[model samples]
Target: MPVLSGAEPFAHDGSEDIGVLLCHGFTSTPQSMRAWGEHLAAEGCTVRCPRLPGHGTRWQDLNQTAWRDWYDTVDAEFDELRGRCRSVFVFGQSMGGTLALRLAQQHPDIAGIVLVNPSVTTLRRAARLLPVLCRVVPAASGITGDIAKPDGFELAYDRLPLRAMASLQQLWRVVRGELGQVRQPLLLFRSNTDHVVEPVNSAIVLDEVRSSDLTEVVLTDSFHVATLDHDAPTVFSGSVEFLQRIHRERAEEVV
Candidate 1:
């Protein structure tokens, strides 16, 4: 299947030595993170938002892929920025947030992390039946376009591939186990009425992660896709400020 029109990956090389790796969620495309990436780029920060494997394409293709393939892609993107930049930060929404935590777990040198409604676990009872559901029915209704902004769009697969969802659960479990290892300074933006990831997801991270420098901001109006919703400016501006703080603190540490 041909990729969606506006679902391509994006990258920008800025004059600053700091780099930011942005990631979207399951069944989602780089389009979800484009605004945040562009905002960082405009502020003279190198940014990369890669199209995850099996995403931004036909839903059928997503079923053929798994978490490993997706993680490998973002991991490579991280390696690229690590080589070129003096410091690197990661930003993600939903499952992208899960992947970002995985990156921080594996690479401890990351400057920090900024997340928007990241998903680590789902308390939904229906999720428990996924293994059987995958065999009986390949997919169900997708979860996308949850932004509160009127006419807001999320470029993602319309069908929720059950197999892909199963893979995501595995990632969630694995990341949860390693949550204690993510010590980077963190900033997480959460939506009050998110239809996707819930408050428990954030609670687990806040309770488990060892990062002493952590901040959480609650969005009163935006839904899951806060990056493109009304609070986007809050997210974008907060991220720039977060990165700047990390940069200054890191430099001070060197002295």
Candidate 2:
């Protein structure tokens, strides 16, 4: 089933003609993408960073939801952005990137994508063991340490919901298999020092996409959460450049 363009479920009455929709990684909230969204907004792009169905408020909330719910939330947010802007782009981090891949596949109108450490491919053997592990392990938090912030502040959400991880695995399977279905331009930024998701996952994405226009950036100084790492400024600048290039192309198309 495809997510068609229409009125957004959420209200965005004061935005400009260009919109960018952002999604956060698993066990994380919209706060992870808040700065990215705001920066895009400051550049005159209408940004929508919605809390995935079971995120932001509590960890247990994730266990109650599945990947479909997460995709639906992003889909509706995309619709909202579409309603207000002439052009829209989808960007995400980690599991959020998986959802964004689904969006790019189904929503052909999307201008392009900026994927930051997208978890399209899980760690070795974990993808194989997910089915049994999810059922055996009860809902609990697995995120081990405090997510290091951009300002050197630490805000940690120390809860690992097995069900949520399971759902994410399911999404990964779907997106991983459907990578060739994505034909839009793509930008991939990866951290070589990422402690969570393996760097090879980015390699998998670049290898699978059928899109002829693709750019990749390696973040050597960052960790798993590249958005707030030492190279965060580079991530921001690169994304903005990608958006600007796409925006310019759209302008040329219009003229």
Q: Check candidate 1 and list the clashing pairs.
A: none
Lowest-lDDT window of 10 residues in candidate 1? 14-23
Alpha-carbon deviation at 46 in model 2, angstroms: 0.3
Expressed as tens digits, the lDDT of each residue in 1-255 for candidate 1 is 677989999999995569999989999899988988888999999999999988887998999999999899999999999999988999999999999999999999999999889899999999999877887788899898998999789999889999989999999999999999999999999999998887999999988999999999999979999988999999999999999989889988999
The estimated TM-scores of all candidates read 0.98, 0.88
Q: Candidate 2: list runs displaced more than 4 Å.
A: 1-15, 144-156
lDDT of each: 0.92, 0.77
Misplaced by over 4 Å in model 1 are none
Q: What is the alpha-carbon lDDT of model 1 when measured against the actual structure?
A: 0.92
Clash total of candidate 2: 5
Q: How many Å off is the CA of 20 in candidate 2?
A: 0.3
Residue by residue across 60-105, what tens digits does model 2's lDDT show?
A: 6777889999999999999978888887889998887888899999
Report clash pairs, candidate 2: 140-160, 140-161, 141-159, 141-160, 142-160
